[model samples]
Target: MDYTALTEAISSKSYEKIAEMCDDLMLQGSTEGVVNNEDWPYAIHLLGHIYVDDINSARFVWKNVPRVVKENRPEVTAAWKIGQRLWTRDYAGVYEAIREFNGSPEAQSLVDSFSEVYTKRMFQLLRSAYSTISIQETALFLGMNEEDATKYVLQQGWSVDPASTMFTVKKQAIVTEQKLDPSKLQRLTEYVFHLEH
Candidate 1:
């Protein structure tokens, strides 16, 4: 069946276009009562997750539908409709759906792999840019409040002024005076040096 050709076609298309393609493919496959290939179902599930992430934008392309309606059926169309509504820039909705989806047996089976890829990409970005970040900037980047950021920096053995409430560049003595495990100390030293230079 020329899977590469289909993949290229899907990749070249916009998200809505891809969703439409998946729906059509799934419906056609269902009519035959057999989807011999696993890719279509996975693609459909992915489309659902994407849709749920950005409902308004997704709805601009695909319309509003009931969430329960979307969830009841495991069909690609239903999943796509739900995904269209679920995945969004709205952090609250996204977070809730992530919790809900990850709790589901079907989603759990896929989420570990999905999250591994996501974490790797996030860490790559963090490692590339984090060292250049100032304390305030790092706080904002990490979505932490100023107090939390200050506490975190101090916890890492950096001096922070209590009165001025600023993170100082000077290294501070460890509060506990306990030696770090050798391997961990080496890693910490490497990280500190990387950040310093």
Candidate 2:
């Protein structure tokens, strides 16, 4: 099969589109030709799944990929390392895995996209999981240096203590009450009453 579409998707950095194409390719069969071909750009497909935080799908791709491909393509293995880190929820290891990836220039954008998505995810997790955490820990979670992490937290309206270098995470208050449409509620209530009667 021609790889024109896949190549175009990679060059355009359309990770979502690439992922869809990969899914289609996998559905066709074992992906023997596509996965093993030197020109296949399979690294982008794997990294694109990671970029979208689809760990299970990423694992499927990794499993289907031939051992020879994994051994020969360091970039493909590096991408899987990131997937493994994510699967285990090893937040620190995610950064390490990303740092280890020295993929060709084409795959760098997908890796960078994954880093951005993961950093945002970690920020949300930190806000929900910790009332107060050290700036050092936050830095690790964010894959940023301490100074930059501190600056980022401050920008997010979180308070920081200079002496201890601990940051108080600004948690968004959860609004428990959901607004219901009065007309719909009345209709549902009437229906319930009728059913009961």
Kindly list the per-residue Cα lDDT of model 1 for residues 81-111, writing each as its tens digit. 3354334333233333433453334334334
Pairs with steric clashes in candidate 2: none
What's the C-alpha lDDT at position 111 in model 2?
87
Candidate 2 Cα lDDT to native = 0.83
Candidate 1 segments exceeding 4 Å error: 1-44, 47-68, 71-96, 102-104, 133-197
Give the 10-residue window scoring lowest on summed lDDT in candidate 2: 29-38
Highest TM-score: give the candidate number.
2
TM per candidate comes to 0.33, 0.81
| Cα shift from native, residue 170, model 2 (Å) | 1.4
